[model samples]
Target: MNDRESKSKILWTLFKSMFMLSACTFGGGFVIVSLMKKKFVEELNWIEEEEMLDITAITQSSPGPLPVNASVIIGYRMCGITGSIVAVLGTIIPPMVIISIISLFYTEFRTNKYIAIALQVMRAGVAAVIFDVVIKLAQNVLKTKRALYISMMIVAFIATYLFGVSAMLIILVCLGIGIIDLIINLKRIERSAE
Candidate 1:
C-alpha cells in the first residue's frame, strides 16, 4: 500500500484521474472502465483489483452508464459523498462539453464526407475496445474459479445469444439464485451450531 494521502490530495487525484479517463477514451463506457482500472487499481494503487472488478459488475448491472456508475461507486468508497460528487462532475463535464460543441455543428458534421469516414473508423475502434473489455471481464470471472459463476455465465450467454432470451430475465434468475444460496448457507450454519 502507498503512504496515506491527504484529503485534498485524494480529491484532486480522483478528479484528475476521472477527467483524464473520461476525456481521452473515445470508445465508450467499457473503454473508460478499462482505463480506470489500470490507473486506479494498477498504476495509482488507490483501489484494490478485486474491488475494482466488483465495481465493474455493479456498474454493469446498474441503470445508468457504466462509467458514471463506476465513478460514483469508486469515489464514494474512497472518500465519501463529496468525493462522489466531484468524481461524477469530472466524468460528466468533458463529454457534456464535447457534445455541446458537436451539437452546434450537427448538420455540417453529418453532411461532411471526411467526418463520415472518420466515424466509420471510430466504429471499428469501438468494436475492438468492446472486445477487449469482454476478454478482461471473462478473465476476472475465471480468476474467481467458481463453477456456479462460470455456468451462469455460459447459460447467460447461450440464453441471450442462441435463444434470444431477454437479458433482464437472466439477471432476475441469477438474483434469485444468489438469494437462495445465501439462505441455504445461513440455514446450514444454524444447523451446525445446534
Candidate 2:
C-alpha cells in the first residue's frame, strides 16, 4: 500500500477506536483511561504502558477535559495535527449527542423513578471504576521504586486528603520538582561523559 493509504487506514482506525471508547465509557476520564490503556497499549501495541502512564499524568495536569486532552496528545503522537482533530471529533461526538438527547427529556428524566434508580445504581459502578483506576495508577508509581517519586506521591496524597491542600498546588510543586530532577540527571550524565 502507498504511504497515504496506510496513514488513512490508521486515521480511520484511530477514529473508530476513540468513538467506541467514548460511547461505551462511563464514570468519566479515569474510567476511559483504563479502557484506552487496554486498547492502545495492550491490544494494539500502539504505545507502551509507560507512555500511557506519562500520558495520564500529562492529561491530568493540563487544562480542560481529560479525555479531550488525552485524545489530542495520543492522536498527535500517532498522526500529527490531523490525527488530533479526528480523535477529538470522535471523542466529543458521542457525548455531545447523548447530552443533547438527555437535555431534551430533562424534566421527564429527572422525575422518572425508574431512571433515578438506574442512575443511583450507576454511581456505585462508577465509584468502583474510579477506585480501580486509582489503585492501578498508584501501583504504577510504586513500581518505579524511586524514593523521591514514591515520597512525592505519598506526600501529595496526604496533603490533599488530610490537609485539604489544593490539588493544583500539589501538581505545580511536583512539576517543578520533576523539572529540577530532570536537569540534575542531565548534568550527572554530562559529568559522567566528561
- Per-candidate local distance difference test: 0.88, 0.93
* Candidate 1 residue-wise lDDT, 1-194, digit = tens: 34345777898999999998898888888889988999999999989988898898778777899889999998998889988998999999999999999999999999999999999999899889888878887887788798977888888889999999986788788878878978988999999999
Best candidate (score: TM-score) = 2
Candidate 2 residue runs with Cα over 4 Å from true position: none
TM-score for each of the candidates: 0.89, 0.95
Task: Please name the candidate that would achieve the greatest lDDT relative to the true structure.
Answer: 2
Model 2 residue 65 lDDT score:
87
Candidate 2 per-residue lDDT over residues 86-140, each given as its tens digit: 9999999999999999999999999999999999998899899889878988999
Model 1 residue 31 lDDT?
88
